[model samples]
Target: MGIVLHLKKKEMACVEYSFHVPSLEELVVVLQKGLKGNFADVQVSVVDCPDLTKEPFTFPVKGICGKTRIAEVGGVPYLLPLVNKEKVYDLNKIAKEIKLPGAFILGAGAGPFQTLGFNAEFMPVIQIGSEHKPAMNGSYFAHINPADGGCLLEKYSEKYHDFGCALLANLFASEGQPGKVIEVKAKRRTGKLNFVTCMRQTLEKHYGDKPVGMGGTFVIEKGKAKTHIMPAEFSSCPLNSDEEVNKWLHFYEMRAPLVCLPVFVSKDPGFDLRLEHTHCFSHHGEGGHYHQDTTPDTVEYLGYFLPAEFLYRIDQPKETHLFGRD
Candidate 1:
């Protein structure tokens, strides 16, 4: 029988967004923003993989893209859908092949063909460097932390999908609020893109002085945290064109460290800004695969790092807040 590849239509749904911690600066920003209430708070630092060192290291390589340097590789561009094609597989085997840092081989989801008889799982891993570090964003919660009550979004896309991406854009923009007003507007100029604009006003007290492990009950699982906070309307669009793609990339590149930082909100009255790194695997998913040279030594692909303008909107406290306080 000919190979039957699984095909999944892109569904726009709400998805959780999270990232790894790269530096102490990011940590501070995340915490300060999440601990701003009148009650006591709890803070804990636990690496996803205890044995995994914070330093960067090199790993053995494979696949057709071997020519691409380690640093040049960003997140996986296309979604690795588990199609109706099957080969002998195990979650443990895949993890080993990918050389992920942690033992917990979290599975994003199963096949595009279930009844058709295809079962597979996806686990994405990255290689960090001296200048590269992991970070996270706190816009939408996937789960909760069992130990210290931290938010979680393990394999976020598995749950919410692309709409989740839009949700996060609004959530992080709001600085984490339940009723805070968020505005998402469309951009006039589009190369096949949607514009999302958001604003929020708050009067909550700063719980910066609150003690750890205090406040209301929140969902916390094994390094997973979930919050029921919705952001105001931001812009929306179908990410399908080169212009829209470039626009999004430029939007993030210019934001600098801010785009790299996590959104922080406290059950407390006070606010503390903590910065964290997030991963975006949303790569160019258009053309079909080209199965060319089997011999790696026969081909060479050029590599380039395109740098562009950085533009990030600064949310002023006195302006977007209820009582003119940040």
Candidate 2:
């Protein structure tokens, strides 16, 4: 059993900080120093799209931009036989696999025009009137798709807020609970906005309750001795009580680039959700390592849902211009 940390009720101040790349030492210092009071933790935030530019490849190495393509769900690739509705299209079974006792499934749909990106071989039947016939491609989850779908998935993530509801709806549906899932109604065009707060509340609406008692994910030990506290990596815990939610959010706000949303994994209500950033645990030979400064520079901010605020008053000034006139 994991050690239980209680989330206590507390008020907080609104706070926000912005900066660019700094030396590793400076980055660590800035990150570590930011810890105190309401700042229990911090996460690195991406300012823009990640650098994926590449030269014409002769041979690809194993790393962030690897050559091999693997689209998996529960160790099963979507591109393989599993893609067939007749063979692997069992929604209830997939729901059982998720182990969510009282799952709230949503179906995110789209018009024919919206299904254009799936212009590839896998979805051979995904052209005009595609929206009329709801296939698994655009209607369900888009992640781990062939080129057309994968490209759309990446673009959707850039404005994830627009598709927040849809993402969750399809995400759950893709996992088998295709029915009863929720979808965000508004349309999104560019990367200028987000709906993280709304999405969090939606998750809570369907999953949270007074019985769960707040708790999200606690740190898992790693490396030889596992001494490091794990820096700027994404992780989550959907705490039970109001206090737990606030505490966990605070823990990440000051420490790394994190965005917390209400998530319901099982009806047990007591299931303490543990979140591990996929990238944090993924790597080829080296095995999932992150640069202290650069990793964060690529992530665009996902509007956070925090109970309290930490608005710093710099009008009076401090030691630096950040506070006002030094």
Candidate 3:
């Protein structure tokens, strides 16, 4: 519903003579002018964190797609329902109701902490903890009481390198075949300092087979220099081959701001790219309308720019940095 476009310093300067138009088609047209004639490689990166859960679906009781306020624990609101006298919980059935084939679900804890993915469009779900615990407010997932687990989910995210592995398992259950998996590991020698290494060989396997593009996310732990990379990886073909690996991390640099903008492939194609500056969480209105009746303002864009090295490291810096300067 929203998108932010940021052009790195070098890329912005390369297109000094061109202009940015509001529509996606316009952007393509402007870009084509510079894209011609032995031009260096230009890559575009996009990260999508949708406000899949709307109003009424906030809590798990009504349905998996709406919002609700559950009972509180330790003076904090945890999005979990108390085991009623009948001891009935309809969350799983609710998930079945909204499941869509080939749907990708992403979740986080202590903040959008727990996420489940199935190749289907179903109620956005987040499950937390064993039982009988307090919940803490989470940013990316549902809010939980801190007393419930003392931010254990955040710790898991840090440790496993893939925060919501359980959710990924849930998502994989839909296909019956595991999709591409990449794991990054770190050793905490100095207070959450991260030294990351890719554990999945398939991560770099897809390089030139598919048309290269960019999508993924990057977050620096509150104050740590160590950065966690969430690359936007997808495939028209189910397998993760060597053809398109680089596309996922393609144009990571340029550190452009994520802003809401219209993306048009041609005069006839367009869609809204949501951008969040502060946090990657937002709730949508009844009918795909963003920023409606949600508290803490739904972020349209996550931030500006992918890491500069992500872009420069790929191939061409001038081509990717086009509109806004970093």
Clashes of 3: 84
Residue-by-residue lDDT tens digits, candidate 1, 106-224: 11222222221222111122222112322121111222234643322333233422211110110111101122111111111211110000000011122233211100001111111
**Once superposed on the true structure, which residue ranges of model 3 sit more than 4 Å away at CA?**
1-43, 46-94, 101-104, 109-217, 221-326
Cα lDDT tens digits, model 2, 157-265, are 2222222120001111111111111112121212221222222233343334421111011111121100011111112432234343233221111122211112112
2 versus 3: better TM-score goes to: 2
Q: What does candidate 3's lDDT look like per residue over 1-326, in tens digits? A: 12233345633111111111133233233333322211222222222322213232232111111111111001001111110121112223222322322222222111212232211111123333213322111223212223541111122232222222211111111111122211111121221111111101111122212111111222221221211112211233322322332232122111112111110011101111111111122232101101111111111112111110011111112112111100
Displacement of residue 226 (Cα, Å) in model 1 is 10
Any runs in candidate 1 off by more than 4 Å, and if so which? 1-29, 34-89, 100-102, 111-326
* CA lDDT, every model vs. true structure: 0.18, 0.19, 0.19
Residues forming the 10-long window of minimal summed lDDT in candidate 1: 194-203
TM-score of every prediction relative to native: 0.20, 0.20, 0.19
| Each candidate's clash count | 68, 33, 84
